[model samples]
Target: MRPLVYEQTRFSPRVIFDAGNGVFEMEGTLMLEDNKVFFQTINRWWRIYQQSPNPQTKIVCKLNYYTLATDNFLMQWLYVLKDIPNVELIWYYNPDDWEMQEYATTYQSNYSFVKLKEEKVR
Candidate 1:
C-alpha cells in the first residue's frame, strides 16, 4: 500500500504515514468537523501498516491543540496501536500546555502496550 498523506486544514491536523520508512507523524491542531471520516482514514492506514510493520515503528504526535470532540477518535486510534508490535508514541506539547500533557498522561494510562514518551516543546 502507498503512504497516506492528508494535508492539514485550519481545523485539522496534517497526517503523514510513511509505511516504507516506518515514520508516522501527526502535527498541527485537530478540530475537524467530521472526525469520523478523518479518523477512518487513519484507521485504514494503520491496519495496512500492521500487515508487515517495521521492526521499530515510531509515531510522532505534535498536535498544538484539539477539540473535545476529538478525544474519542484519538483514544480509539491509540488503542489500535497497542496491538501493533514495537510501537512507540512520542507526544510533544508546549511546555506550558498542561492540557496536552494531561491528554498524554491519559493515553499512557489507557494504552500500556505502546511505549509513550512526553516531550516539552516551545
Candidate 2:
C-alpha cells in the first residue's frame, strides 16, 4: 500500500504514515468538527498499517494543543500502537507542562529511559 499523507488545516492536524520510513508523525492542531470523520481516517490508517506492516514504527505526537476530545482520540491512537509490539511512540511535551510528566510515566516504565545517541550503525 502507498504511504498515507493528510495535509493540515487550521483546526485539524497533519497525518503522515510512511511505511517505508517506518515513521508515523502527527503534528499541528486538533479540533475535529465531525468526530466520526476524525476517528475513521486515523483508525483506518492504523488498521491497515497492522496488516503486512513494517517491523518497526516510530510515532510522534507533537501537538500544540490537545483538547479533551482529542485526548479520547489519542486513546484510540495509542490502542493502535499497543497492537503492534514493535511500535515505538515518542510523545514530546514541553518541559514546563508538568501535567505531561504523568503521561510520560504511563507510557514508559521507570527503567525505560536510557541515554540515546544518534549514529548510523552497520
Candidate 3:
C-alpha cells in the first residue's frame, strides 16, 4: 500500500503512515476547524491497511495539542486497533505539558494496548 505522508502545518500535524514498513506516526498540533475531510482520508487509509496489516504494528503519537474532534477520531481509531493483534500504540507527551500528559493518561487507562511515555527534550 502507498504511504500517507503529510507534512506538519500550522493547523495540522505531521502524519506518516507506511504500511510496508509498519511505521505509523503522527506528531505536532492539530487545530483544524474542519477536520472531517482530513480524518476521512486517514480512516480510509486505515481501513485498507487493516486488510493486510504487518506482523507487528506500532503507532506512535506525539501530539502537543488537538481539538475535541481530533481526540474523538483518535479514540475511535484506538477502538479499531484494539481488535487487531500485535498492534501497540505509544503515546508520547511533553512532561511539562500537563494537558498532554492527562490526555495520554486517559488513553492509557482506556486502552490496554496504549503505552504512555514522556517526550525527550530535544
Judged by TM-score, which candidate is best? 3
Better of 1 and 3 by TM-score: 3
TM-score of 3: 0.91
- What residue runs in model 1 are displaced by over 4 Å at the alpha carbon? 113-122
Q: Compute each candidate's TM-score over C-alphas.
A: 0.90, 0.76, 0.91
* Window of ten residues with lowest summed lDDT in model 2: 113-122
Over 11-93, each residue of candidate 3 has an lDDT whose tens digit, in order, gives: 88999999887789998889998787888888888888888889898999888888767788877777778876788988998
lDDT value for candidate 3? Answer: 0.85
Of 2 and 3, the candidate ranking higher by lDDT: 3
Superposition TM-score, candidate 2 onto the true structure: 0.76
Ranking of candidates on TM-score, top first: 3, 1, 2
What tens digits encode model 1's per-residue C-alpha lDDT throughout 1-122?
A: 69999898888788899988766899888887899999998998898888888998888888889988999999989877887898888877776778887887888888875444555542
Error of 3 at 10 (Å): 0.9
Backbone clash pairs for candidate 1 read none
Question: lDDT by residue for model 2 over 1-122, one digit each (tens)?
Answer: 67778798887778788888776877777777775678777788788878877766667766655566666666666666677756677666655555444444554542232112222211
Model 2 clash count equals 0
Q: What lDDT is reached at residue 6 by model 3? A: 98
